[model samples]
Target: MIIRYLGDSELAQVRRRRWRKVFYVIDDDLMRLDDDRSVPEDYRQRLLAFRQKRLPDILDLADVIVAPNERILEGYPSKKGERLDPCYVTVCDDLRHFDDYQTIRILFPGSRSHLNDLAFLQEGLLRLSAAHTELEIVTYMGANAPVRLKGMEQIQHRKPLPWAAFQKEQQRERFHICLMPTVATPFNQARSINKLFDCAAVGAVGVFSRGGPTDGVIADGVDGLLVDHDVMAWEKAVGFLIDDMARAKTMAQACLDKAGLCGNPVRVRDFWRKQLDI
Candidate 1:
């Protein structure tokens, strides 16, 4: 059983080899690659070319198709005789519990591709920084600390690390809040709930965009706050969480509880076991 993650350039080559049980995991809706406003122009153009030239051949060779969620499957074209069997495998990382700290540590753990999303919260974040002296911004994955955030004294930037190291370091650092702002584009809409789980694993309350991929997972005002994709709404949510430390802590704990039960590693392992028939 060969498990193929998205973005592997050698899929067509793999197909030529005729491997047994080749499963392709579609992490994002590649059909909307053109609509991704966050990716660099050259990279996006190259990706579009690759998809156009190689996708049909790869699809013909794939035995099973997997997606992060049900919604992502809607992006694929329907097959005539052969039904496209799309499996939903959510991102399930290990869960971690941490102690709350004095300073309000906010995190934006996205790659450079999240430029548009981060831009949406620029004004709100700046306002938050100005109002709260204890606000600290931690960025990773080559995500430059927003220029608007440079004026703030408490901004910290860590170079990107391997996924395993990131999880360990994130839990150890124990940021209070995780900001996950998204735009209303096709690429953004088809995103998975990975960010929600990433924040939950670190015992951080996630402030996400309303009606995004995480809508069904996060209960607004309960485990997390889901606000409209606007600066004012983001500011209000951030301020509300900052002013009430106790509530923020509670929300963080609640997030961990929900994610632990629903997105446990055991569950993910079992899913893989059943899917792979190991």
Candidate 2:
């Protein structure tokens, strides 16, 4: 799948060939190419040029546009956009459930692009970490993470790894809960539920933002918890799990079951078969 924006020669070559095209929309490039400050200015400018000149044509020529989520597909001008369901094959054998554990480890995983999202909910996270000495928050965001979470004894800052390395490494560590907070931005709105898959891999129950990506899908008090962006709301949502081990245990199992369904070998095989038309 051609996820990245193509160069001039590559575009020409693709245009010349009479082949089936599947364009994977990895990110909301239109929103980020110019505005994303995390990227270097020179690289951003070059990417913006490519996006402005070649992106429309790429979309126009694509036979299928594989979007990460329904929101992205809906916002996309192309009707060929298809939202992909994530399949998790790499899971940890021994998961540290909330039971028998004094410290509740909450994984707050994100990348450079998600700094703003983390920042938005930093206050709530700060309060939670401060109030609960037993609650530990783990993040792969490193020094780029929220300042509020810094210097906290419970907040762990792991060195960011490459995608492949991270996938393998994440399974090695055990987490009780996974925190997924999304800000209501165009770029964030277009994101996929990959975090849910990550939670599944580590056997952690998810606590995602209600109006964000987890909207309408996650059953409240069942597989996961859906919360608003409010400071108290986040604290309350996480605190519920921390206070009650039984509820957390049940939710973790339910969330694992849900993730199992998503990662079913036959289901994944069928999805790809249909998507690839093979």
Candidate 3:
């Protein structure tokens, strides 16, 4: 069996090959490209030509179809296609959770493209920062971060690092809470639970936007906090964690426990075997 992780050109080369082929669809390129207003004006045409046009053709040749998230699977053409039971995969690694840290650290580890989503909470974050001097706001997106947080004393904006150095960054400085604020756009809806997994890896309890990728996993107020994309709600959720250290620790541990189930390599291997009928 041959597996292609969103490699349209590679899959195209082996279209009529004898071996079984699988295509993993993580993003709906058509939806993204079509929503030109939401997407950057500069990247629209290029993305449409390549991702929108070239990618979907590979789906027709695939013997099996796999998607990391359910929403991604639902976007596929249903008229005439072989769509298998979707396998939700998590990109998690074995990293020690430093939950016993003294100070409260809040992280927003997305790229500059996520600036649009974070704009909603900029005002709330400013208020939260001013009220709580002990809270530390950390972000890799320096200039892309909320304008009010740029020069704040409590907030620290570090330069973005490569994927390989992510664990190292986590090791050097542990965070207590990770914030993920997403809008209800097609692109945002199809996002994976990557941020949640990242937080669980480093023993950070995540506060995610409800109806986003973390829906199936996070049990609000238990493992993680799932709230609406409102300013006050985000502020309140962060405040709750800050005020109650014991609860925060419990939730962080719970999140790690949930992460263990999703991130297990053995389980993933078994799932692949079953999917491939090996």
lDDT of 1 by residue, 197-263 (tens): 6776556898999988788888998989999978898999989988887788788878877666656
Candidates' lDDT values, in order? 0.70, 0.74, 0.68
Q: What is the TM-score of each candidate against the true structure?
A: 0.83, 0.84, 0.80
lDDT of 2 by residue, 1-278 (tens): 66656777877887787876555555554544445554435656766677678877787667766765765566466457767666776654544465566878888777666777677778888888778888888888887777777888888888788989988887787788888888776567767767777887787889898877666667888989988877688888888888887787778778877777766667757877887789
Clashing pairs in 1: none
The candidate that wins on TM-score is 2
Full candidate order by lDDT, most accurate first: 2, 1, 3
Give the lowest summed-lDDT range of ten residues in model 3: 79-88
Q: Against the true structure, candidate 3 has what lDDT?
A: 0.68
lDDT of 3 by residue, 165-227 (tens): 865666555577888887777767766666776777566788899988888789999989999
**What local lDDT does model 1 show for residue 239?**
92
Order by TM-score, highest first: 2, 1, 3
**RMSD values, in order shown:** 4.2, 3.3, 3.9
